[model samples]
Target: MPSRTRTHNHQLSDPFAAVLQPPPDETPAALQARVEQEQEQKRVSDQIDDELRKERTERKKRSRREVKVLLLGQSESGKSTVLKNFRLKYAPMQWKAELRSWRAVIQLNLIQNVLTLLDLMQDRLAQPDGPRPGSSGGPSSYSPPSYGRTSMDSTISEITLASSRSTLNVVLTQKHRLLNMRLSPLREVETDLRRRLGAVDPEFTFANGEDGAMNGVPGERRKSAREFGVRGWIGALGFPTSGAARNSDEPMPVDKATEILATLRDEIISLWEDSEIRELLRAKCLRIEDRPGFFLSDTARIANRTYVPSDNDVVRARLRTLGVQEWRITLEHNESFGSEWVIYDVGGSRSMRHAWLPYFDAVNAIIFLAPISCFDERLAEDPSVNRLEDTLLLWKAIVSSKVLGKTTLIVFLNKCDLLKRKLQSGIQVNKHMLSFGTRENEVGVVVKYLKDKFKDILRSDASQPRTTYLYATSVTDTKATAATLNIVRDGIIREHLKHAEFV
Candidate 1:
């Protein structure tokens, strides 16, 4: 419920350079010989383990094959969008919510996805990592029975087993700084826009963009994130609520918020009851409630469309993709020759990610965002930077956390189409460093370039050298393919397999 306080000025060169960890020690030759000798007697036991795994995979092939996936990133990163799109084949537009809350749910899913990714990494890495975070290697053969750092129910959990087939545990830990890069909704926009409709409204004051956000006053007070969502309607909306109020007690005026949603829903549903209204809603494709107030008319209508619906309860519908099924799991071992994984996921705001690491003592892999196309842009020009800093802060938190290399690390270079375009167009973006007057499109560069320039950010005590892979993607569609993600996911799993061999 707290807004992140990390500022760009706080992000500096990694000062911790002397702490790289040594690789895991190999079994001494004599110890290895002894183990091999012991293995002669236990050959049947090892064979049984192999046979069980092969059997499980074969059995799972005929089933739903549940794989736990965790998604992690800063606030507003495309983690949720990517996940929503990933399962598009199963159910499109399932996780609906008011837009702002949609972002919140996305954040939660991100955390869940992180946990799920860890489950996959751990299950795949199950072969060699030493005792998992919470397992003791029993026939229960299940992941550690604990929830993540911020399980949705963070309360007493009921343990239920899947009908026993094949499943993977994953964890998603997303630390979103700013929940949404938007302004207040339902303000007197008609009054303000009336002064200047077609033109970039003149009342929108932005003499400069400092402290990373593009909303600024060159020499005076800067505008808050609330203003940018609607190009500065603050006077009409009064001062936007503080971070605390906005996050918890009140997010926008509840009365106005509900009214807006109900109005849209009524308008859209009326169309279904009558053909004319449906046509009108389709041509307009709604974009209101600042940023997160997305929704729809009926559950049936929600299931019927892929684009933003034009009608009631548009907030949540816009936020969630239909039937979002993201997940993450971490299993810590209680015995030897086995290990555990802790997963994290999307729960908008870096604050959510900040709550995920302790459970990660069992983490086996991390899914990080490396929007390569972002490397060619500057944060200042990025229209959605209100929440970008939180992501970096979250990354900083990860690189500096205690879960160094109990697992493998995978960095997805998302938004690949954008990156590919920039590279083809000969544009070079730098995320680690930024200059004045940089444009929005350039912010991608900074996001992509953060690591190459910030050494301390990725330093860990583990000897594996925390791995990263670039996954280029475009959720709204610009020639992005699931294959790109497959390449990234497969690469991470393959390397994870090699790493697990030592466990």
Candidate 2:
């Protein structure tokens, strides 16, 4: 067998050494021509290598990620569908729950993304039982799953049954396998330093809504490390997600998620920069993945793969904090250029309005979607005021002290299709609307209006990373919509991310 060497640091096709070698000495003019030819060859090789990587990913994928994007808005704003979308993507195994309190349900389609098996875990259970703080009882009989156990999917969305709390806790964890799975998916390896350090449970609190005070636990602080479900209770611990899957003795294309994430991350940042709302940093929460590496590989290979089972230390993505409700984050990556995003979608429902605040400080960009189908009599005579009220709150928070203008805000005039439909129905708009004679024209004027205001209103001493223009976007679940998004992605986002001068 061929012995493995240190992992490749350059693009697979180019090799690090190839990048370092200088061209043969030649006349300055001839060197320029030679360089162009070299560039062309490298591009072709990149395309080929891209195809190879995609093939590898698709050959064994089984789990499709469904992100639980928490949406927040007032009573009338859309919220239910956002939660429903999450269910459609990450609905659990045998999930059975009344819609009485929850928002929506989602079950991801994996057949289309068979290469993700390496990314999926069959052992869905991730419960760790622990006695109360002062109790001396045995560790909660529950444990994060032994190495390589797998759970078969039972085709039920929910089950209302009774059982001991121990089994119930285990079952609850199993139902949310995908969510628990994303908490980094690979566990930390056992380390002496981690064991030596003492653990402390820092108080954890988050608001249920924007401007909503942190309502979790106030009177007491639980030692986070002593908790049962806590990994390395009473201390800090984590290992590489990539290292767990690859044998120290074996070789692999990428050893850490960061390299994979870095390549993917730069592309996402580029897309954000190119957005028509790139200045606004809006219209970007969309995702693209599962095509495998750079191109499509045979779907059949993805549909079939020999299963290898082992369990060592893979980080579980579950959010486990005492006195805190559990949450699932199923983060996934795709070969497509725009698959790295985890958008907190704006769903139009009353229940979802409370989820918007906590993450505002963390996101690098914010897409403030303003629907065009409003203020036509049913909404309000004062459309902008009504719209501004909700939006102003969001803007204030993102630019607030916690975020400190760290995030870029992108405003989008969403549902442009609604405008076209209105025009077709003989609804009269401004003179500019008639001049364009189509939905596209009406949107252009609206975008122009937003751009001027963005430049005018947000030009302030405190705005560190400047805010930019707004774009009119139409997001429908269709091919034309995808094409439209791709154009904005290429022409706008890509351009700005590659802006070397800014760096």
Candidate 3:
């Protein structure tokens, strides 16, 4: 019987097999070369396999070590800002790319402000015949000279209306220029931008309405985020209500949107800063201060040709979290903690709270943010309910959750900066918050009072009480937040390691 020969087959593809197989009737030198080539290829393949196996081993170890953190708060409670800060710290390149998309959102915010201001101005101008709504209607104490009084007053009022109309007319033209020049359906603009960058997933829309509470929380009503501003803005602008074909013109370059705002920057700022316009707004009870991106005052800077939003600007830019967004970032600073960390930023509105229960059981820790500055503010969705009251209720629900009872809880009494400013401005907290009666309206005093209130709730409501840590955080301050994040990271790592040891 012929001697049998054994040949090892590595699963090489057809192209590789042809090159690897030795020719028949090969000479010794040729056979030696083929053997060496085969050995070399095998060595490379084995090295790759070794590396992959090591990676798998490491992945398994990391899966056991992974930490999941949830950011919980009411809408605009600064949860997303906290998430952005994390991205800024650990994934700057990605954050910088994200800023490009934010540019459009910023522009929309600016447009929204201008549109609102103009509408109020027009309403006031239209009503020159009587005292502005909400204004004191008592007759003037000093009567003007009777001579030609009626004719002169009528002439002056007509001229004032004519002037405002002229300004409104100009504003109307610019508004159309911006809206019609391919600015609608901001989603497509963002999507096109991502496509240009070779991104497969659609970009996240950061506008602050829809899929959230109508007022800014979940309980009001669910509206499309698109319907919040862009879709409805056309009718609001007093333009033809007819379904004007969506600005199908080529996507406006980010820089082009900036340029459009720049060209109209003077008009926008003038209207914003006009003392007369300000008076009218106050009379109309249109308080822009409570709204997001009140940029009329910052027009010059926002409209600058080379303007790139700073970290603070991006934080101040309002976008309501519509649903749960997850980010997986490799931990670089606290290497002892784990290989990766996953963070979930859920929409803080009431309706969105339903989504939080699923995450509670899985999250290793919770960063609960409450805007202490919001004590005097009212919930946008429900005006009768105080914002601070809503925050307190939300905090109670989170800390008391049965599923999350064991999760590490870190409370961030956020917006301390705004709180300090509000106190210093001589705004009486007791006047707005009756419960705050008889207490000193000082920053330190108010902060401690608020902190104690939160702690009392936690102490009373937690299913299984543990030490709940609190921080007076102003997330806009990167250095301060970074330091706080480190403390949080270290605390989490220690707990994780201790838990693993016990397990």
Q: Write the per-residue lDDT of candidate 2 for residues 1-503, one digit (tens) a residue.
A: 11123223333456766565444355678667867888999999999999989877653231121112233333222222222233233332201121111100000012112112212212212214422333331222222211111111111111111111232111222323433333232122112111333222223233354221111111001111111223331122232323222243332233232232232332223322332212111111111121111111222211122111111000101112222122343323232332333445432222333445566554444545555433131111111123323443444444443453644455555556655654455444332122223334354565555445344445532346465435565543233334443444343334334431332
Looking at candidate 2, what is the lDDT of residue 72? 36
By summed lDDT, the worst window of 10 consecutive residues in model 2 runs over 100-109
Which one wins on lDDT? 3
Residue pairs clashing in model 3 are 213-217, 215-380, 215-381, 218-350, 218-351
- lDDT per residue for candidate 3 within 400-486, as digits (tens), equals 778887789889999898888778866667655545668999988888888888888888888886888899999978889989987
Better-scoring candidate (TM-score), 2 or 3: 3
- True lDDT of residue 226, candidate 2: 18
Question: 198, model 3: CA deviation in Å?
Answer: 18
Lowest-scoring 10 consecutive residues by lDDT in candidate 3? 156-165
lDDT of 1 by residue, 85-115 (tens): 4433122222222223332222222222222
For model 3, the local distance difference test gives 0.61
Q: Model 1, residue 69: displacement in angstroms?
A: 4.1
Q: Put the candidates in lDDT order, highest first.
A: 3, 1, 2
